[model samples]
Target chain A: MENFTFYNPTKIEFGTNKEQLIGQHLAQFGVKKVLLCYGSERIKQDGLFTTITSQLNEHGIEFIEFGGIVSNPVLSKVREAIKLIKATPVEAILSVGGGSVLDSAKAIAAGAKHEGDVWDLFIGKAQIKSALPIFAMMTLAATGSEMNTTAVVTNQETKEKLFIADESLFPKVSIVNPELMQSVPKDYLVYSAADIIAHSIEGYFTATDQPHLQSRIVEAIINTVIETTEVLLSDSTNYNARAEFAWASTLALNGLTTAGTAGFNFPNHMIEHSLSALFNVPHGAGLSIIIPAWMKWHHSHNTDQFKRFAKQVFAVKTAEEGIVALENWFNKIGTPTRLSQLNITQKDLPLITDNVLNNAKIFGIYHIYTKEVVNTILQDAL
Target chain B: MENFTFYNPTKIEFGTNKEQLIGQHLAQFGVKKVLLCYGSERIKQDGLFTTITSQLNEHGIEFIEFGGIVSNPVLSKVREAIKLIKATPVEAILSVGGGSVLDSAKAIAAGAKHEGDVWDLFIGKAQIKSALPIFAMMTLAATGSEMNTTAVVTNQETKEKLFIADESLFPKVSIVNPELMQSVPKDYLVYSAADIIAHSIEGYFTATDQPHLQSRIVEAIINTVIETTEVLLSDSTNYNARAEFAWASTLALNGLTTAGTAGFNFPNHMIEHSLSALFNVPHGAGLSIIIPAWMKWHHSHNTDQFKRFAKQVFAVKTAEEGIVALENWFNKIGTPTRLSQLNITQKDLPLITDNVLNNAKIFGIYHIYTKEVVNTILQDAL
Candidate 1:
């Protein structure tokens, strides 16, 4: 294990009816008013919006609404939402939806105090300092955004997607109710499971020198995801399955998996971001399609990691066979592994490669994944 | 899965030379002056004391020193430290040693504000409303006081050891460098490993339904400890082994293992506290002796949990066999599994049983471990 630092300060309140208690929790943070940012309608009709609003009223806390955040969370919309928040004098951003809206709310919190464009932060022009306190009542279990400092957003005009991590942007509190996940569509649940698996494996297989403890944590999370995903895909309304998935996914990438490991940059995420940016695919679908291809191409970078992954995750014999098992697992869950299957044209592959190279480079072992290498991976993926 | 809520708010600054970053990190918490609390002269001689003090001077922070805290930190010693801290007028408690000193420091932080005796909080007579900001440079791997809200203190006069837990006692920051743990003696290392395994298993075999994700997490941490401990026993200077052990032990009881599961009140802790109070044994040794005996006596009470523990941790076919395997594992690690091996008298057994049952009706299983149950487990241990 190489030297590293780990710090995640998000306070997670998990269980049934956690959202209803959010009002009192906000009181603990001393927020008098909030920007109630979410996607439109689903939450409101389900009575979550009213329940939370009533609770806030009970505490005499006010809120302004900013709904209709799209799946990709475009930059212009973020700017407009920031404008809306500023106009309302909201004290914090209280996001009440899936990853997209929470990601947008994070941007909005940072953007409200930012001097220049919010895109500057995404592009590494300015460091994140203080932000309006952000809180979340997470309805989805996919991104682990509720516990992590990562926020991914898209730029419409440039057709570019990127993520910015700022420690200051961690949610002051996250209310996770697994019951909320039951409202999600089956395909969405499957996609979320794929996303979590990708998150755990990236941290697992990329270690410069793998430690047994870290490997065990990675394997456990992966195994839990595998078991719970099967249960969830079969019955999305299974409360126990939802609860297990909700906790597993959150713990996977909330800085726990990457505690002391080195190497293995999030190459899959970089590639998936390219897919999501140009083709408008679901984030997890982009990952589900990219991971196996990237794994097949990159597995030899650390054969031992792949062997461990094969045995621990899929209970397979060899590293090569494990990759096949992963592919089979994804196919079983209806997450396509090919770019053509995700409806991306072969012409777009080179651009995806170029886009990843233009950004940050991943470290060690597979130390030579340049533009050509990335494109080769994309071609193999196609 | 049962309903539960989990939250850990401690910020862990981990890596090589993380102690040097402490002064800068503490400034963010608005702590200009700290009461530097630690055990013995080891930290001073080990160079951690000078390095931390120099860093504080570099950051323009002031501190007052208080040392000589012992194993199983006593309430009277804590009171003496409290008097010193009050006179110094520091805003925070900076603990620079193992869990004992940190636990004592937390008690001082919580008790300094109250009008009554600090022991009141220990005996459950008072609630900790607020605490001075606490920071730590961790030199120990067990107890997990770095990232939790619990402080266990022993009352030497009464031979009573108890703990106080409150949200306020959560450390503002904890700096964990695997290098710090390198200097720990081999016996202490094995004892801590046993303690970590006990912590992982204490909740692992709880009386809960569908604790899938949580059970996996418990196993992962325990398995990590078992593997890393072996490596450390053979090669103490191995960085990878130390890192794995450090991370696994911390995660063992940082509230992750109990998520959405019925909490098993720590029976090992209950039994061990008496041993620590009377004999001055290492905290982990007491736990190592008590945990397996408790498991054997209580296995029939919750066969499901025991069977799961068997399947996961020991890879045994039956719960009864798993109980035997656990006892053997303890012996293999050079930690005892019986009371008599520690030279604890038969007369002392009843007193320990009486103490444990005075608190929990059900010690660890689904059914209550009343006085009769406690006697049975203790008798089995002997």
Candidate 2:
């Protein structure tokens, strides 16, 4: 284990119907007004939007409505929300949808506090010194965004999916009502499982010094994601499975899994961002395509951890068997195992490699995933 | 899984040399003057006290010193500290020792803000609504009071050991430097191992609905504690093992393990408190003596979980074998396996049972560990 500092101040209100108390929580935190951010009309269709606004109204809280956030959330949406927040004075950002909404809300929160463009923070031109407090009522369980200090957003013009991580962006309070997630489409649920697993394993195999306890925590998250996803697929309304999956997803990347892990890298996410940016594929789908390929290419670097993953997660003896078992499980869960399944042709390899190299540079992982190395990984995916 | 709210707001500054920055952390939190609490002169002999006071002096922070907190800390010490704090205008209680010091500091912190007697809060006569902010630099890893909201204290006069758990008791910041724990005596280390294991497994067996993920986490903690304790016992200065053991101890009881387990119980701790209160035994030693015996008594109620614990933690097949294996491990690690090892004879059973019944009534666990049931468990310990 390596020297590290672990401090996550996000307060998660996880349970059934917990979303109904979001307004009360915000009020208790003295958030007088908030910019309510959401992705699609599904929350409205489910009457969740009405409940939230009514609760706020009953609490004597004021809010400005900002919707239309989309998956692979873009800088354009973040800019729009930032402009809205600038025009008005809101004390906080209340994200009422999924990861995309929370990501946009975080970007807007930081942008509203900074004098420069929000993209400046993502591109490392400026630092996020302070931001409006963020609160959330999550309707999805994929990104672990509710309790973390990072957000991913696509810069459409530049064709880049960039992220900003700063201590100031962590949500002050997040309400995770797994019951609200029962209506997630089967395909989305499958993709969410992949996303959670990706989070759990990314650091497990790459850290220079992985603590025994941290590895066990990562395995716990992986096991929970696999088990709960299977149950949720067979019966979507299984509340226990959904609750377990939801909490496990939050813990997967809330900084607990990688606390003492020095030299840990997120190369899979570094490569998959290119897939999402260039092809507009769902984040989890992009990961499913890249993970097994990356794992195979990188397994030799950390053979012992790979073997441990095999034994603990897949009950297999060899690293090769573990990678195959994971790939098979992804296929069983309806996630794409190959880039070709998403209809990308062999000719698209160079474009994907170029995008990934740019991300590698941004993430400071270019030393490991050089242009040629990324090309080989993409070829493996094909 | 059950509907639950998971929110732990304590900030942990974990890693090497973290203790050296305690003053800066307190300053950042706007603490001007603190009631510094600790145990015997070990910190003074080790120069840690001089280092802390110098850091505070450099930071221009003021403090009032309180020391001599012992293991299984008593209410009289807390009351003495509370009287000193009331006379002074300290902003927080800065604990500089292990769990005993932290527990005593927490009692003082809560009592300073309450108008009534502090024991009233522990006895269900009052609630803790506010407290002076608490901070800590932990020198020991057992009894995770650093990042939790609960503190146990024995009433020397009544011989009634009790605890008070409230959100206000959670420390504002806790610095855990495993190097500080490297000098722990081998016996104390073994007892600490038993304590960590007890915290991990208590909820695992008693949760009404054990989520697969939570169970895996419990097993992970148990595995890490067992592995790390063996290494530390041999080498004594192996930093990695010390760090892993320290961290696992914190996570074992920081509200994460029982997050979704609605009806989880802590019968082992409930029973062990009495042993400590009546016999003046070390907290972890009492736990080691009572754990296997309690498991044997309670295994029939949660047989599958016990079997799973056996298979995962010890690679055994049956619950009975698992219990025996754990008891053997305890004895191997130098913890007391039988009550008689502590010079406690069969004649002491009635006195111990009476003390445990008082604790059961206080903890509201009488439904599970009734007087007769606790008597049976204590008798089995003999």
Candidate 3:
């Protein structure tokens, strides 16, 4: 086991109607006003916006609406929200959608506090010393952004998808009402499943000193994600299934599964971020395409962990069978497993690789994930 | 899937030499002075005291010693510390030993702030609304006091080994350097193993609405505890085993395993606390004796979960076999699995039952854990 400081202070209110208490939670935190951030008008159509606004009014709190954040959230949208917040400052950021909105909220929170460009924080040119308190009413489960500090956002001009991590960026409270996620589109649901599995496996396979305890937790999260995903596919309204899937997604990247594991990096996420940045594919869709491809290429380097993952997660005999089982499961769940499925071909491999290389440099993994290595993995997807 | 607010805000610094940074951690919390709490003078003999004091001096933090806390920590010691703190107030309570010391520290932290008797907090006559900040450098793993809100302490006068749980009592920082635990006596190591497994199973079996995800996490913690305990028994100096065992112990009761599960109560701990309180048995020893007994008596109530536990943790076909396997493993690890092994006779059943009934009442499970039911479980232990 490696040395690690595990300190996620995000208070999660999980279950049905938890979003109704968002205003009370904010009030408890002493926030009189918040910048209500969301992805689309879907929350408004679903009555969630009214529900939250009514609660805020009940608590005598005020809010400013900031919508239009999209998946694979962009720096431009985050900057716009930051600008709005700067003009009419809110005490906190109330993220009312999925990971994208929450990630953008975190970015806006930091950017509103920072003097320089918000993109500077992502590129490591400026550190996030502090940010406005963040609270979330999650409408989706992927990205684990509700509980974690890191926020992944794409810089449109640079075409680079990067993340900024700081202890201060962790949300003060995150309301994860799985009921809110029942309305997620089928594609997005499976993509969330794939995304969660991606989060679990990255550190599991790559950690140099893979502690058995951490490995067991990763397997638990993956197994739960896989089972819950299958259950949700058949009956999206299954509250237990939805709850478990949402929780599994949150735990996947919430620092619990990766703690005490040494030298782990997000190679799959690194590559998928580039795909999402360049092709505008959904983040989880990009992950589903990249994971198997990367696994096929990288399995030899960590054969023991792959074999363990095979037995533990897939109940299969070998790493190769485990990879195949995962890809098959992804396909069964209606998530893309091939570049072709996303309408990308061998011709796109170079562009994807270059974009991935840029991410690799920013992630400080360029030494290992060079252009050649990335291209080979992308070709495997082809 | 339950409606629950999961909010553990304790920060854990886990790794080698983490305890050496205790002063810095205290200083980070703006604690200029602390009442350093510990058990025994062994830490002094081993130079841990010198190391801690030097760090305190270096950080310019004042400390007043309040040692002599013992295993199955008592309310008297906590009261003494509380009185000392009330007389000469400190910024925080710095616990420099294992769970007993930390549990005492939490009690002290609460007691110093409360106007009534400290035992009132335990018996639910009073609630802990606020507490002084707490810091801990744990030399032990069981009880998971390092990263949880609950603190278990025994009242010497009433012989009620009850716990007080409040979010306010959570330590500001906990330093878990597994290296510090290497010097633990062999008996204590096995006892810690039993305690961790006991923590995992209570919620796993007793929860009315057992979520598979939570069960998986509980199994993961149990599997890791079982595996690491065996490893540590053979090679106590093995850093990886110690680290995994320590981490597993922390995770067992840090609210992760029980989250999203419904209607779960700590019957094992409830009964074991009575045994420890009445007989002054070590917490884990009492647990080892009670767990199998409770399982035999209660398995029928949650047979499916028992079967799942059988297959998942013990790889057995029947809940009976799983119970037997766990008992045999407890015996194999040199922890007692029967009342006779603890030198308690069948005649003592009524006494233990009466004490347990007292706890059940306080725990609000008296309807289920009637005197007859408690006696039956105790009889099974005999």
Q: List clashing residue pairs in candidate 2.
A: none
- Model 1 C-alpha lDDT per residue in residues A1-382, reported as the tens digit of each score: 7776667778888888778888998898898998898987888889998998998999989988888998978998899987786676788899999899999999999998887788898877887887899999998998999998989999978877888788888998998999988888878888898999988988787667666777777788878888988887778778888888888889888988787777657778877877787778998898988888888888887898899889878888799999999989989989888888877778877777766665434223244667677877888888
For model 2, how does the per-residue alpha-carbon lDDT over B1-382 read when each residue is reduced to its tens digit?
7777667788888888887888898899888898899999999999899999998998899999898999999998998888887877799999988899999999999999988889998898999989999998999999999999999999999998899999999998999999999889999999999999999988899888888889999999999999999999889999999999999999999988988886888899989988899989999999999999999999999999999999999999999999999999998889998899999999998898888888888777887777789988989999
Tens-digit lDDT string for candidate 3 (B1-382):
8888888888899999887788778888888998999999999999999999999999999999999999999988888888888899998998988899999999999999999999999877998989999898999889898888889898888888888888888888889999999999899999999999999999889888888888888898899899989988899999999999999988998899888888989899999998899999988998999999999999998888888889998899898999999999999999998888878997888888889898998888999999888888888888
Shift of residue B95 alpha carbon in model 1, Å: 1.6
**RMSD to the hidden true structure, all candidates:** 2.4, 1.1, 1.2
By lDDT, the best candidate is: 2
- CAPRI tier of model 1: medium
- Flag the better candidate by DockQ, 2 or 3: 3
Ranking, lDDT, top scorer first: 2, 3, 1
- Every model's TM-score: 0.95, 0.99, 0.98
- Sort all candidates by DockQ, best to worst: 3, 2, 1
Q: Which portions of model 2 show Cα errors greater than 4 Å?
A: none
The reply for model 3, stretches above 4 Å from the true place, is none
Better candidate by DockQ, 1 or 2: 2
